[model samples]
Target: MSEFAIHSILLGSAFSTAFFGLFAVLNAVGQIIQRVMLLRTPTWKRVYQKKQLDTRPKDAVDQLPWETWRLVAGVIGVIALLFVLWGTDYVYGSIFGLGAAYVPSFVRRQMKDNARWRLRLEVRDFVAELRLALALNVTVSQALEHIADRSGQVTTSFIERVRYHVERTLRMESPEKMLEALAEDFQSEDLRKLLVLVRAALRGGMSLAEALAQSADSISQNIVASAELSIEEMPTKLILPMLFALFPTIMLLALIPAVSMLITSLSGVPGQP
Candidate 1:
């Protein structure tokens, strides 16, 4: 009888300790996610310098979606972790499994996002290059080739790809048509709108340099407005989890000793004293 009671106590203690540790770790992870979700991630440049990176300009123009990948990886990770912890004390194996599945997709998403941001920054520069070449009596095709040679950074991008395609496919296509084709390959709405205005300038025989400057100024204003909106909302986002978790945690910490004493007293007077 005594042996049975001791074994039962041991089992209970082991499970309690395991559950307590798991809940604490999981809660910490939740807090991290909540905090990160609130961040604006000003740019994706930092996410670009990791593994599975293919910096091909063609690939940059068309990025793969990662939300579905997240769902698949999460399911697989949970299954794998459940298998590992079935009869083992290694409950933390779940953390390793989830991270293994998540990190690659996260890295890829960041790279694509960063690439989009760079595209935004370089839009004005691209227009300036085109306008300058036109001012110097260069043909549209010649200007594209020159931009490709001069402006490429760590990765060749939609700009370079469009330049190469125009040189090969349609030697007679206008500069506006080339930009429109480039916009088709890319998913940027701003670029598409700019391409339309550029095409209109060409059709109406307007000054190309003036049109480019106008479009560039419009994009700059949009970027500033977006930044201001993000800043205004940051305080409320930052407070949400703290109010929900940290405040309660502080109260629990303050009340813990009294709660413990009440529980002890309620256990029938501590051996009849």
Candidate 2:
């Protein structure tokens, strides 16, 4: 083939491949957008917003500066790989750079998970403390303040937020309103349920101490049950990784000699040689 024709054919193939890849990426992104939009009901949106709040780190001072730096680093890395190293190196570098931008988000997600589990545990402790405080004849407001002081970081932050609203708008008749608001803010089913029962019992003139004590016991039981369930499932979770890693290695070791002998026999054939 002529040099011009060969170059033209290569260019056409490259353009076609690039175009198809771009189209696929766009199609995948569109599908994700559609799926997200489909679930954009008011209730789902509220739940999503609560999740966002829970996942966001309270200590985050500023994201803009770090995000800008990441953007610049990605651009520089892509340019260096594409211009200096060329070819597949550019593809790999671009992927790595793009993926690196999402590392912070992945880290945040893991942190959020850790924080959530810790919060659940801490909340159990808070409930226990509140139960004790109520038994000691402390008021609901006083119990909250005491727990805010005594609880771990995760639960303390949550209580402090509630304390802010409570202290700001102290009402003698309906102290449970502050707790109800706290439950709404927390978006935690356990916390919400406990608060709702407390509100109902207190409103009905039931013994606050006994109600709180019951709530504490139930929350403690739930926490223990959840932990036991996780322990039970641990072995099942390990099964897949053991199959993927160990099974392949064992099979490869068993087959290597047989495969090698077959290759040797084939190579020794006159036609094969």
Candidate 3:
């Protein structure tokens, strides 16, 4: 019945109310997102199913759409922000929370970029191998089967998908149509060029081996040129990181001792506490 006890009870009640209110808001947002996802689920499923018929083992949790994961990340970020707000300055908490919210998306973007780079390298290898296979006078389908048997990790699934479609529609569709469709799906210029040459060969406009050899050489040269250019630009690319991250860190470290000494000196001055 004392003032301190009454203040504690009121504070506890406020904290509980705030926590529950935040939880309710987050729950409502999640439900809305879930409903939106559910409404779009059928379309997504249909598109994926139509594009890819092969069954691949995937974790149930991994199957959740990126939007759902982003939402979860955002909710976690908001909760973390609340904790930060309670424990630190509002400005720092806001900055930390905003950065945390975008972390998932940024990581996802980097992953996708890395995957694309790997796929580009894999496609170059695939083209070289296909060219070699063609030089042996094997049919395009046979060459694909040979490549699929030895494809790298990045392209194994993609090659298998292509092979599946090729075999499934062998009688009803030309390889050109299948390749064009795949090129559209992947949106790779290098792959599209290779497919275009292959299609030309399939249509009897050029010799298959000659066409593949040319495509392979062009792709190899491009890859080499890209590698050399990247090497040449490496130092330039590193300059920004040094300026933004390394320089500031070095400056901070160098200034810390000087700042501390100045502060100590000022504190030691007569009449200064």
Candidate 4:
């Protein structure tokens, strides 16, 4: 082989080795981190307890378990950033490996977004069930208990909690106070809005059940409108994927045989002897 060809081969081998080495190192680092976390249960518990004391909302405490991992990730990021500053050829790989640590949180956020949509639908159903029960002349506490029997798995515990508070309120405390607590526990905007309307109607001497029935109608209508809009927009959303993903594969498939035949014909047309 010529010097140029030899050098090209060596360079390609080096690049491949470096790429595979970096990937292996990243995977090893992740495994090491996981093992270390598993071994340090006491340390993790201490940090979790401290975080729980410091954080107000229960939801915010979810991040506490990842604190050690975040710290490890930050250290890795700093090292990668330093390596990048050294002007190495694999600087981009280092940066990417460093970013791998953040993948869990990003994935968690996406899952949470999907969960939020599902939870919103569940809340809508809960409200509609309440409306139906109220329409049948059931008292609020009894309505909550009735829904608890037939509600979705997602809202069953919430329904039971609400029913518990309602029963307690009837004996000693105010039902409004329990509703306020329930709203806080769920941290749902729709629940809060419904509570506000219900609270207002009760304070205004209007029928609480009737007001909730109207609110339920509004919620159902809004959900239907949203679904219709999403269906209407589906074709627009699919345009880019069809243009980029499906189009290229199809063109390649259509041209491959013709291109191969042309190449074969060109090779057959050798220099005339």
Instruction: Judging by lDDT against the true structure, name the best candidate.
Output: 3
Model 3: how far residue 267 lies from native, Å: 19
Lowest-sum lDDT 10-residue window in model 2: 84-93
lDDT of 1 by residue, 11-65 (tens): 4334433544455567669979966864635346436532214332456424554
Once fitted onto the true fold, the runs of candidate 4 whose alpha carbons sit more than 4 angstroms away are 1-64, 85-87, 151-171, 203-206, 221-273
lDDT tens per residue, model 4, 24-54: 5777799999779757779878688677555
lDDT of each: 0.59, 0.58, 0.61, 0.60
Write the residue-wise lDDT of candidate 3 on 155-273 in tens digits.
34457656555566543676666666666656778888988888788788998887878887887788788779878988997795455445334534544554455556768964334
Clashing pairs in 2: none
Best by TM-score: 3
Better of 1 and 3 by TM-score: 3
Residue-pair clash count for candidate 2: 0
Q: What's the true lDDT of residue 205 in model 2?
A: 56
Predict model 3's lDDT versus the native: 0.61
Ranking by lDDT: 3, 4, 1, 2
- What lDDT is reached at residue 269 by model 1? 59
* Model 1 misplaced stretches (Cα beyond 4 Å): 1-57, 60-80, 83-88, 137-139, 152-155, 170-172, 229-273
TM-score list, all predictions? 0.54, 0.52, 0.59, 0.52
